[model samples]
Target: MVFLHARGITRTVELPDAEPLHILRGVDLDVEVGDHVSIMGRSGSGKSTLLNILGLLDAPTSGTLEFDGVPLDRMTAGRRDRTRGRNVGFVFQQFNLLPRRTALENVEMPLLYDGGRGFWRRRRLAAEMLERVGLGERMAQMPERLSGGEQQRVAIARALVRSPRLILADEPTGALDVETGATIMTLLDQIATQAGAALITITHDPHVAARAQRVFRLSDGVLHAEEPILEPAA
Candidate 1:
């Protein structure tokens, strides 16, 4: 089943004093449920721009985007916000958790925008998500109290608490040490796999790209793919 599809996508950013920069030029892509794709590119190569468009954080200057068969070009901002929250989860380089909030509270923040679930149920779900991310012991710890890896775990917990069908992670390991980065990716890969959510990660490191099932390289707003190695028969 197709979870997300974009065709003939193009995005242009205008500048006051110079020519407009085209970030994505006729990029086409498709992602089904549970597929993990890594988009790798150098800085200024439009990898992050593509991710932002895919996550609905920014709209394409011109193109068609469909999420679960729903067209995105015509959606109002308010509707888009709701749809994004309900269908898409985001993990960033910076954990972006509130400094003053406890881990539990941070995980519960997404529920505040939702109205259907009651307070107790939201609390329960948040706690469960924290446990799943291996942060149950740090539920009461604030952001300052947690390590970089632990904070990213809390961010992942926050993203998963919404039960999103798609997770878009932008440089999720950018701020951590080698050991912590590996740990974060291991936890995220496990969590995303268990949930059967499609994962789209954008990164500059080729090693990071190797972790995904398929990898795409972006240059001049276009995509290129290297032949993937095949595993031996069991």
Candidate 2:
């Protein structure tokens, strides 16, 4: 099933005393359930802007965006917020865990906003998620006490706690060592697959981009699909 559809999506930022900058021009993408996609671009290539639009955090300047066949512009602000909160999960390079919160608490934060069964059983769900991420023993550890990889694992657990249908990972492994980053990517792919969630990763690393089923390169406010590099047979 198609989870997201974007057509002719464009973003423009108007700066003071400067002409409007076009960040995305006529971007078109279709992401289906369980799809693993990667968008690679340099530091100022507007990759993050596209991600923000896809994740429903921002609206496109022009064009249509549909999530689950419903147009984004058709939804009211509250409905959009509720839909985003319930169906989208984000994992960032910085491992955006709350500094003062324990791993468990950080994971439980999302459930707190659910206001349903998830809210009532947030503790158990958070614990299970942390355990699934191989951090059961460190659930009580503070962000400062955990290593970089461990902190990222906590962030991943937190992002997956709700079993969101779509997972957005931005430069997910940028802060980790090569080995740790590889491990994290593998773990992320496995978990997202098991949960039947669409995974979209935005990165500048070719190695990381190659891990996705489909890859695209963003340049000069445009996105172009890249042919996947095949592996040698054993």
Candidate 3:
């Protein structure tokens, strides 16, 4: 099934007494379940903006974005929030964990937004997720107490705790050493695949982008897919 489809998407921000700044223009893309896509671009090239739109954290200024074929712009605010919380998971370069919260508490954060059976069982679910990321023993440790890789691992666990259908990772390994970064990416890909989630990674690093099955380049607010560097099994 097509997990996400975006067409003619544009994002413009009006500046004070100046022409509107177009962040994304005429972008079109499609993603399927279990697909891994990487988009590479320099800073301020609207890569993050595109990620935001794809993740449903922000709406496009114009054009259509459909998640599971449902128009995002047409959904009510409440419905949009609920759908976003339920289906999208994000891993960031900075880890984005609550500094004061223990690893378990940070991982439990998503469940609060997804109030249902899992939310009621947040502690157990969060622990299981942390364990899945190989952070079971570190569950009680604070973000400051963990190494850079461990912090990112905690962030990954937090992102996956909800078993989101789409995972948006923005420079997920930018903060780690080469070896640690590679290990983290491997762990992320494995867990995401096991969960049957589509993964979209945004980064400026070609090495990082190469890890994905398909790659794209973002320039001048547009996205163009490069030839696949690594083909998946037939």
Candidate 4:
């Protein structure tokens, strides 16, 4: 049931005239299908670096990374790109929507790389996703016209439009008010659950991190699991 696996993963960046800056050190994680996992860290704690590695956007300097049991290092560059595009979706702190594009068109962007039924029916599929996010009436609106929450919804719809099996959200609620952020997180969880996709959220907010079934904290290049909070029975 492990959809993505990482063990002893390390990332280091060498400076021109100084010692190497270590971002991640021997981090290990296993993400299963339909799992909701969260990683909490301060601004300089390498949360984004870990997320990029988990999403296959960056490779670890050492150790192993696998997706669906296939080793990432074993795949060719082209295959890796295709695998990531087909299976992983990303939501960022900033909505990252194209300012000029309509909400529907933004949602359709990912399908353009599909080169299959999704590509052929991009508009319809995008519309359906937008509707699911409760943005059907505003599908034609540009990013500027949408409020912060609405823009994030468009981003979420765009991320899910291709029906990715895994969703990586980096500070997804960072830019919103508390109420809107809570609403967005609930919507994200519901949609990911409906799609049977694994969710990994990286955030500094404990309230945000608490939404995940499992939580880990990253500090000084190391990741440690926090004890889960058990709810009281009714």
Worst 10 residues of 2 by lDDT: 225-234
lDDT of each: 0.87, 0.93, 0.91, 0.93
lDDT of 3 by residue, 26-80 (tens): 8999999999999988889999999999998899999899999899977998898
lDDT of 1: 0.87
Taking all chains together, each candidate's TM-score versus the true structure is 0.94, 0.97, 0.96, 0.97
- Give the clash count for each candidate: 0, 0, 0, 0
The better candidate by lDDT, 3 or 4, is 4
What's model 1's lDDT at 169? 93
**Rank by lDDT (best first):** 2, 4, 3, 1
- The C-alpha stretches of model 4 lying farther than 4 A from their native spots are 229-234
lDDT, model 3: 0.91
lDDT of 2 by residue, 1-234 (tens): 889999999999999999999999889999999999999988989998999999999999999999999999999999889999999999999988899999999999999999789999999999999999899999999999999999999999989999999999999999999889988999999999999999999998777787899999998888899998453232
Tell me the tens digit of each residue's lDDT in model 1 across 124-232.
Answer: 9999999988888999999999998999999999988888999999999889987788788888899889989999999876656778898888888888775653432
Error of 1 at 173 (Å): 0.9
Measure candidate 4: CA RMSD. Answer: 2.1
Superposed Cα deviation of residue 210, candidate 3 (Å): 1.2
Residue pairs with backbone atoms closer than 3 Å in model 3 (clashes): none
